[model samples]
Target: KWRGYGVATADFGRADVTWSTQFIGKATDFNADPGDLGYRTPNVFYHNVQFAYDLFEKTRLMVGIDNLFDRKPPFIQSWTDANTDTMTYDLLGRRYYASFRHLF
Candidate 1:
């Protein structure tokens, strides 16, 4: 199982900034075989940042922070409740978000 996601954005017309990255590659646990020992499960990266402003004509505000340096999910032994591999990873390590938007 491999995944990837990278995004970068910046603007100065109404205040805007964003940075995101989430990649999870390197997995080998087909029931654990071939000299078992956790089989293999390494490679994880997660970081996110967002900021938006436009609290005026229309109203708009946003803030975000997801797993930005607080990542922990690299243990999968056929999946055991919370041992890791909770649907790909990311077990809510770091998260902070806010959003508000209006339009007429």
Candidate 2:
């Protein structure tokens, strides 16, 4: 199996934006026979984006979204939980997040 991540960021003074991608290559279920249904899973890509701004000299606020496209995980024959491979795929369709950071 192959996996990769890519990220791009742009900085504008006290603010910045970032975009990222997560890729999972197609995989075969060794436990399933070659002719069995659902023996293989298709590759998938997940997108994410974030925006950050400096709220103060020492504080920063950030907001981001995960699984921007609401990509669904591929099905695997050997794994029954959630009807997909949770370990190798994303189960959460999409999610949002916010964070604050301060330094002393």
Candidate 3:
């Protein structure tokens, strides 16, 4: 399957607008991840956005949006000896965070 892509915004003397939305089948739940739950794979839609600016010398301000669509990891399988599921969990949801860096 295939989709489409386009630009968001572009302006000088100000922050640039950049974004991307993709729906991909991404699954990762094995024995080495954060949680060890048998084998669970789920379809995921990812999104990303970034707003950057050069504040000062070696100082940069970056505001990024990850998982903007609130995409979450697939539900992990339950391995219980009681022949029933006791605990189950999934990945985090859409997160909005900011970050700053100094390349000094």
Candidate 4:
């Protein structure tokens, strides 16, 4: 499988904003054991948006949300003991974060 990202950003006054999107192309694992889920998986996409503001000459604040689409993994009922292949799929739908940084 192959994964890639798309990003865009702009600056406005004291704040800089950004938008990023990630894509995971479809893949097939022919070597998977018979007890595993399916041999193939569908493509998936995720999005994230963030904003960073200058709080001080040396300090900055940033915030963002990931998995904006809240995408769920494909269903797999035939698997041995797994509801969904969390190892090869995304389980956490959406999440958020905040951070502060200061440079000396």
- Best-fitting candidate, scored by TM-score: 2
lDDT, model 4: 0.80
lDDT of 2 by residue, 1-104 (tens): 79999999999999999999999988888998997777888889999999999999999999999999999887778887777887777787899999999999
Number of backbone collisions per candidate, in order? 0, 0, 1, 0
How well does candidate 3 score on lDDT at residue 86?
29
lDDT of 1 by residue, 1-103 (tens): 7789999999988889999998999888888785566688888999899999998979999999998899888877777798777888888899898999999
TM for candidate 4 is 0.73
Higher lDDT: candidate 1 or 3?
A: 1
Residue pairs in clash, model 3 = 70-94
By lDDT, the candidates rank as 2, 1, 4, 3
Clashing pairs in 2: none
Model 4: lowest-lDDT 10 consecutive positions? 75-84
Residues 4-70, model 3: lDDT tens digits: 3444655444356578766544345444355455354545456778787768767777787876777
How do all models score by TM-score? 0.41, 0.89, 0.47, 0.73
After superposing candidate 3 on the true structure, give the runs of residues whose Cα lies further than 4 Å from its correct spot: 1-14, 25-43, 73-90
**Alpha-carbon lDDT of model 1:** 0.87
**Candidate 2 off by > 4 Å:** none
For model 4, residues 25-79, the per-residue Cα lDDT tens digits are 8866555654466566678888889999999998999999888889887655444
In model 4, where do residues sit more than 4 Å from their true spots? 28-40, 76-88
| Candidate number with the higher lDDT (1 or 2) | 2
Q: Which of candidates 3 and 4 reaches a greater TM-score?
A: 4
